[model samples]
Target: MSRPAQYHLLSLPDGSWETVSCLASVIRCRATTPTVIVDVSAVERLTIDALAVLVRKAMRLRSAGGELLLAGPGPAIRKVIERTGTGPLLPDFYDSAAALRALGDDGRAWQRVELSEGESALFCEPAQSPYCRHRP
Candidate 1:
């Protein structure tokens, strides 16, 4: 029988910069697991620096044969990922159930196209639209 995958959920506050770093370190150190899920649903205000940290950490996890999934991120945090080109770096970005589905079922790689020079950050109005307002 196959063993169950290990998963970790990290919930960050609005301005908890250290938590992001700490979680990254944990993921780096805990390399035995095949899956790690970070739930940033409570993150209301995330800066570019924080996103960079997350991307780098996720990359490290991926390099070690582990996948980092982001689940139920708030609008602000999601916008940061969309704006800073970090979403593509992640294995999967989705709601709770969708994230679970993507845990280890490697059917296809999610669409992770790189953004153009003039098509980076995207700003969504009212925070309800599925699409982002692309900005140069």
Candidate 2:
């Protein structure tokens, strides 16, 4: 029998390299999964560094036969994704459920993950580098 497509709901923090790095780590952990829907509803601002991570990761995931999706980005953030040339790589959805539905899933059997700012610090390099030290 064919395996069911797996989905992860990753709720991101404010658009900072530190916090976004933690979110990136989580996505790395689930690299083999079929889909990851990032919840950006709470993020009022999105940094280019954070957007770069999403674009890079999304490209890698697509190459590996998986996909990374974004959900609930506000008008400003949405415009950024598009103008930055990442809109093609990272498809934006109205919400997590909408992303799931687009993938032909019921969108009910997904796992949700979130990381706080304190937890994100653990994923950053010492001295508060401009970027997370995660390679690949």
Candidate 3:
């Protein structure tokens, strides 16, 4: 995918079970960018359970011939990600702009994408979503 798409995830402030729960449908929507970026700037900390959600989403995107990268982890959250030993798997950036550039998105601010709506982040899905777990 040339000029891979970029999608942003709302920062999780509390990292609590409730915050995680509320993100369920958004993460499982099966419609995201070829390069989904989970922005963690506003997030202060991340739990193992919370990281699991990210990994699952990344895996789902990967299965569809795409990839996922974490963006902007603060000092505390950076410690959590490193201590968890999932750095190689999750691959984070210092900030979202660098992440977007890494994904080949250049200065295309018009292509900004979001995941909370439960619809395609950049465009609508086809009749059968290639990333849908239900697909056989």
Candidate 4:
């Protein structure tokens, strides 16, 4: 089977400024594919520096022939993106399933994995067991 694309979850807590920069750098260094999925559901606020870092990282990913997909961005972050006129630079935005579908080769290969102990469901790459190292 083809390897699943790397997935990144960028949760923005109240003090995400420091965290976001570190995450962005990690993604830049570790990702082999140009495609990255940034999950921003946990973000409550975005600072200018954080936003700039995100934009720069996204651009760098694209220039390297990779794409960045954003998901779970809160209203605050959305507003920031709009106000800064950076929406165009953002890659496709979608909820979890949509994001996975967008990444799949056939657009029809994805599955939802129910978490153990009633945690939450995670989208899994088609034919791969959820939460497996190869499933991301």
What TM-scores do the predictions have? 0.64, 0.72, 0.67, 0.66
lDDT of 1: 0.58
Pairs clashing within candidate 4: 34-66, 34-67
Arrange candidates, best TM-score first: 2, 3, 4, 1
Residue 109 CA displacement from its true place in model 1, Å = 18
Best by TM-score: 2
Per-residue lDDT over 52-122 for candidate 3, one digit per residue giving the tens place of the 0 to 100 score: 77776666667666666777878886787788877766778988777767766455552566553445543
Candidate 3's TM-score reads 0.67
**What is the per-residue lDDT of model 4 for residues 1-136, given as tens digits with 9 covering 90 to 100?**
5433455444445426677776665554444455567777767788988888888878876766656677777788888899999887775465655677776755445443222332112322222222223312
Cα displacement (angstroms), candidate 3, residue 13, comes to 3.4
lDDT of 4 at 30: 42
- Which stretches of model 2 miss by more than 4 angstroms? 1-4, 30-32, 105-136
lDDT (tens digit, per residue) of candidate 2 on 40-96? 988988889988888877876676566788889899899898788888888998988
What's the C-alpha lDDT at position 50 in model 2?
88
Instruction: List, residue by residue over 27-129, the lDDT tens digit for candidate 1.
Output: 4433335456777767777767677778876776665566678777777776777777777776445575678777547554333222232311221223222
Q: What is the C-alpha RMSD of each candidate to the true structure, in Å?
A: 15.2, 6.4, 5.8, 9.7
**Distance from true location, Cα of 9 in model 4, Å:** 5.2
